[model samples]
Target chain A: MTVVMKMKDIFDCKLLMVDDEPELRKMVNEILRREGFVKIISASNCNEARQIFIHEKPDGVILDVSLPDGDGFSLLSEIRTTSAVPVLFLSARDEDENRLLGLGLGADDYITKPFLPRELTLRLRAVLSRAYFPVILKRTEKPIFRLGKTKIDLNSGAVITKNDQLMLTAKEFALLEKLYENRGNIVTGDSLCRAAWSDNLYGYENTLMVHIRRLREKIEPEPSTPRYLLTVRGLGYKLTGVEDR
Target chain B: MKNLMKILTRYVLSAAGVALILLVVNFAALITWTTQSGKTVRKNYDIAQIADSLLRSDGGYTLPETARNKIETNRQWAMLIDNNSGTVIWSLNQPSEVPQSYTVSDVAGFTRWYLNGYPVTVWKHPDGLFVLGNEKDSVWKYCVTEPMAIMDNAGVWIIIILILNSLVAVLLALLFGLRLFRSLKPLAKGIEDMAEKRPVELSTCGLLGDLAAGINDTSAQLKRQEAALSKRDNARTTWIAGISHDIRTPLSIVMGYSNQLEEDAELPQSKREQAGIIRRQSERIKTLVSDLSLASKLEYDMQPIRRSEIALAALLRQTAVDFLNSGLSDSYDLDVIIKEDAQNAMISGDEELLRRAVSNLIANCIQHNPNGCAIKVTLEKTLGNCSLTVSDNGVGFKQEMLDDLNHPKNSARLENHGLGLTIVRQIIKAHGGITKFYNLAEGGCTVVLSLP
Candidate 1:
């Protein structure tokens, strides 16, 4: 959990929070600050937001559509002439038309008012991650997955759970990666075996089943009746919600 | 006005044509009557002309050469009777067919019956009384004797008149029929337009003008009523919208602060537990407010369903996975079973609404059966309909709630259950579908949403 938060470089980055409501700006700033975002400057109007963009050179911005001075759209256009900094719209206007308009204007994301603070933090982290860093997505080189107490450090080829670390073979890690790649969806057995075993698919079915059983034992609390790693009878297997379950 | 002119032209042409035909026909019949009766019957003019012709040609007391020649040429014979002696004093070309000498009784009988087939009439002259006689065949005998021949000629004339008038009748029928048809054509088009929910646009004229005016009035009334209804619905939507905006902001603050406190590990156990309680209760208020707003939208049919093609099986799987990942207690297990056909079964609907409908059913299962139970979401396609069933091993809905669902008009009964099931029904209805409540024989409730 700590590593995922550290992956996004918010230490040197700055965010400009623009909203007409002082309370919402304060609340969201507090939430982001707690999530390791150190530098967040606030503005209540588009002119102040624009000035902050030029002076402070914020890495990202959270803007409200309705401002005391002007709308968020004009400010977005003004910002566009100078930089390609990521902008997320946080507004009270939640209609489909408004959402489309904001997104079409090249904003990173659009979140309506009265949203979950955690959701905002997660979305902002995602936008920052995608915009600044492109290395975290290199699965073959440095893949890291966290599920409950289990963490699969694919680079080191180890599964750590409850202060105990277990080494994993290259094939087991490969199968697990395939399932994780298509999370919350059924991964067909044929495709799983094909991905883990490059060729000789005719005889790979039994081997794939054995590998699945072994992988479940490592991840499931009760491996006899797995919860997260489940079988779909004749068709495939689904790996779902490892974080919460 | 144009149609009126056409109708007027038809009536005038028909009447004038009929009058001219009858005039010619009646004149021909008159000539036939006069000529046919003149050859035989000695009417008053025939007798008078013959006597005058005889007197003008007479010389001294005997018939002169001109008188004899006139009598022979005109085919007439005359007898002179002396009034003093009451006897026949002179006679010229008097055929054996007539009684030349006559007593007072004989004169009366001959004049009354035209004795011996000689049509005779007596004219009292200066010298003697002249009785003129003509042969019955020389004139039209039946012209007076049988007056029905004149009626027969009139009958022929009437037929001729009617035949001529029939041509005009046909023309008049066509002209008026055309005008009537033109007037009624717009009425048909107006009715079709109204059927399509369009306003009636008809020009009133001719015979159906009154009816067209009535239709226009009805169209205007329909438009006014629709506007009024839309206004009412808009007012309701705006009210609910305002409520959502005003209520959610404060609730967000409450939930945010309490959540932060509950997550603070340095806080005392009692304080943390208290914070948790506040957070959970505030979450409930938030749910209630959101449900009320959605219900208002559904009740008025004001929520526009933004639709798209959705892989329903994938959505079902996604719903179950999301529920498992929602960070709730692992007291309940939710999973999905999708058939191969259902995996690719694409249903058209608003993704957000479908998500809400399915999520509500799963939430209901976890909420009502606090002891926890298994939830299974199954998806399948049959024929053209997609049936999504959210089944749970928990106790099914109470009998009272099930019965209340049947009669939604009873407000008291509707309040028995929470808004979740009502929302499910409304959302599915908006998608042109229906929802059915069933208790599995194996001891659970199955909410079936059949989408078309």
Candidate 2:
């Protein structure tokens, strides 16, 4: 709890809380206020909520799933278009479908309703911590693997080589790293489900397969014959050649 | 038409009932009239002569030869007998065999007689003795029959005619009664069916067609309202999904930039502090927006249930463990009692949705109850359904609030009241199931749910 609060105290941005229930809004406000929040705003409905968002320019917003005039989704859309503020949905709508939908709609985090104030605070800190402290950028000097003149920096995200000419999309990089990270773990078709869809892993194996194939075409030395990555019989694909075996 | 036939039959039966009552009344009147007129018959049949003779000193009285011959040739034999010894003193048909005397009191007791094909009356003389006679066989038999005798027979015929007339009156009353009811039945049926909110089955009976038509109009209006409500519900659901998608785009950018800022390594402590602020506030915004989306989803349509065979007992136990592991179980004491042999109670429903339903029930218990309050969850299997009940010793709802929930027809605006129970209702309904909310007499609320 202290670690989460420590991370949250570093961020000095405006916070907006929207819920129809006054008690809940007050409870959340008290918790965030004690954490050294610089500015805070609250609204009971979407109509008033939109005005608050426009005037306050909050960096983060806490919203109830249900509102009187409209809902948090519409308000999220309006705020997202004109401003860059991460929306974290705190709702009593705890169904998996709801959570999946919220995440799919670019929600940073989904907290079920009747949540503990401290739990929400912790989640808020974790999310805020991710945004404030950048992952350590490992410096890689070894160039063990090369594909399409793209020398793979296995330790760091850097794709560098002797020629120093490489281009790839974020999706492509994520796919490649995912395959290499499970070098010997035999990452099954089901294991990569949540990372992409953030939902149930049923009947989505083909979609993951397509993403993997697309990643290989971009990085493989020869598109038709992959040297570094190998598919195990009747199981799943694995990354080879880490020890040059 | 079958309806017309029904009306006709009812009228006939009613008429028959009335006619039956009249027949009884007429019979009583006929018997009374016959009894009173019987005395008149006795007086005309030589009853006056008998009284005059008894008044004289001697019993024997010599009549004219013509009168004697008439008496002797009489077809109905006459006998005067001694009441004490059964001795005959005078006889018309056989003087040797019949008794000669009869007690005057005994002679006056005759009540009935049959003459020819028609029934005759036997009269007891009010003054003297008995007289039993039919229409006389004489030249002026009609004239010989004293005017009183003629009157007695005529009176009998007239009373019989009166009885018959009363029977006709009853039949007419019954017929009219049937007609009146027939006309009102359709209207009555329409009113009854209207109360039930169903289409009236009665085709308009005459005089009630307008009433039936009115009821049909109201039913049509109700249908229109139902259609409009259905359309609105559909539009609202679609709008929620659309709005959720719209909000996601900018949210991604805000989150992306916040992530980038936090990851910058070369930044000084002051900038990093600023970056931290940016990231935390961005997250708070995301929470608020997602909460709004969830609110809209609840407001619109509940997510459809996808059914599959699942063991409910296992699912409930797993959910309990999940809640406990999530740290809510410790804050609020949880007591779980699954019925013995509850295993193999497989149900067909959306597993995730069912889980959500159970989770909401448990969450409500935890939320409403004070810290350290015991929350009880029980699972039982009944015929053709599995039931799960969640109860807590929390502040229960009032009766009026329960009434409002039971009957939502009041168009109550419970939108902002909270969606935990409302969503529970919607999900249960989608599963073709139901939920019951009851406040225990001691304390708190218990929600019982049943699934097929």
Candidate 3:
């Protein structure tokens, strides 16, 4: 069982960023500040980073691969000796070998330089949340969803409307669960078939359409002109989130 | 090895031809010598006709004046012996030391061989035996005789000897041919190895020693050139990597600051829009730098491909979905249609690179059409190969760009399309696939990527 975490708790976590460039460190500091991260400490080299990391005991770390005094991989190994703190590598090396090496050395994520500010903040937040507040990330795995007035209980394969209850077959439940997972985003017919039939969408194209129709009839207010369950023509289908309508 | 056999065959044929020419020359010389010697002997006179000219008269045997004159002018002698008396009945110009009479055994001996020291010719006449003698040491005569049975089988003997001679000639040819083949085999192999870029070292100690040495030198020179070329390529790749790496930090700073300013609510709308443009251009620069580095790495085979089995249908669907979900505008629409047969089409490739290739094609369509376009990506399995087609209904490709793509060696105008399409071609080529680009007649372009 996992509990939901408040946004304030995420902003309260401490983050340590280590890079060789001072300007990059300052820019990242500013970016994090704007993203509502209250605690962020920085170091310019490996020695300073090690000192800060040992004394400050930060909840997460963002490290660069190259530094003046030493490289980040060895520093990561050194840090791993005493702690399980989430470490994300931010470096200019975008080669696959470097990415694999960083991840192979127990990094939580590898983000190349010149990245979008939002992407960096989001990755940093995810790493921190995974490390200190994993229960909050797991809370969204609940097996229940609401589509308009119809309520879906995935665990029991039941659709409860205002006055009556309906049941979904195993295949229908699988398809609904896949669509619900990517709610408000397009879920391709191929992906849905793989989820529902545990096979490809070759011979199951019409079978998938029939199942989607039955699923919409159970979950939507108007089955013919569906509001929640929708089709993105030539692509696949999209299920709207509960708050969309 | 095939060349070795050709050389051996030529050597054998030449050797046989030389032997045959020698045999024909010797036969021709023998015939000429025999005919000339016969003509010289005939120029002297027909010795047997002298007896016919000797006519008997009332006086002692009278010789014809012509015959007497011929025998005397030739510095020769003539005589006749009586069969009853066994004595010389008539003689003319006979040497004084020569016997004028002969017994039966003596006559037989002189007729077959010689009279004393003189070589003579004898002919039988109705009157007696006639003899003609030449000067000593002027001619040589010998008698040859064979049994009838041996003479009768001479044709068979000549044919047998001819066959035996031919067999020996062929045998000798084969022996010399094999020796020549031994000397040349290694050199032929060396040349072949050099052609294939393999190191070659041949022994320089035979009839073909100079040629072998030349081949070895060429191979060594090629090896040196190859090493130098690889070194240059390595330097180029490293330079690109260094430049791209060095630019990343400053670019990150610029992008970060510009993004912050663009989202700042206190700024004026126009100012924020200007900041947004700056951020977007900076993002474009970031893409350019990465693409430049990737293109270099791929060109030099420096990028390691991580291969895995990929279902192309699912991959295409996921790519289209990601684009749509990432906020593709209403003006532009993207669609993915996977053929039923292609839904199970699987390939072994680097998933990331292939995904990037697909993404580049779609991005190409979006980049070319600012006013919006409809992009359709389709996947199908044809003849055991996976064929992916990305077509767009928009401003089609420029004719120059299509020409540049068709002839990649002169791809000077590839910069107009950016490195996106070029990198796509490189990635697909690396995976042993072909990329084709053409404009649709309906005012758009289509790119077909076929992977085996």
How many steric clashes between backbone atoms does each model show?
5, 45, 0
- Those runs of model 3 whose alpha carbons end farther than 4 Å from true positions after fitting are A1-8, A96-98, A101-103, A136-145, A153-158, A167-171, A194-199, A203-207, B410-414
B1-452, model 1: which lDDT tens digit per residue?
44555665676567667666676788799999989876545443454554455443345355557656666777777887877766666677788756556788877776666757777778876656778767676543332455787777987877777676666666665676666666766777777777677988678776788999988888888888888998987797778777776776666677777888888999999999999899888877677666776777777886778788886765676566566656546688777777656656777899988999999999999988899998888888877889899999888977867766645673212353468888888899899997988888889899889999
Candidate 2 accuracy as TM-score: 0.41
lDDT of 1: 0.75
What is the per-residue lDDT of model 2 for residues B334-420, given as tens digits with 9 covering 90 to 100? 666667655447778878767877888887777566565677888888777788899888788778767766565523144444555
lDDT of 3 by residue, A8-127 (tens): 466777889999898898988888998898789999999999999989988789999889998888999999999888998887866734555535788888788888899898898888
Ranking by lDDT: 3, 1, 2
Clashing pairs in 1: B39-B138, B39-B139, B39-B140, B40-B139, B40-B140
What lDDT is reached at residue A10 by model 3? Answer: 69
Give the residue spans of candidate 2 off by over 4 A: A1-245, B1-14, B33-215, B228-303, B317-337, B365-377, B382-385, B391-417, B432-447
* lDDT value, residue B199 of candidate 3: 100
True interface contacts reproduced, per candidate: 0.13, 0.00, 0.77
- Weakest 10 consecutive residues of candidate 3 chain A by summed lDDT: A1-10
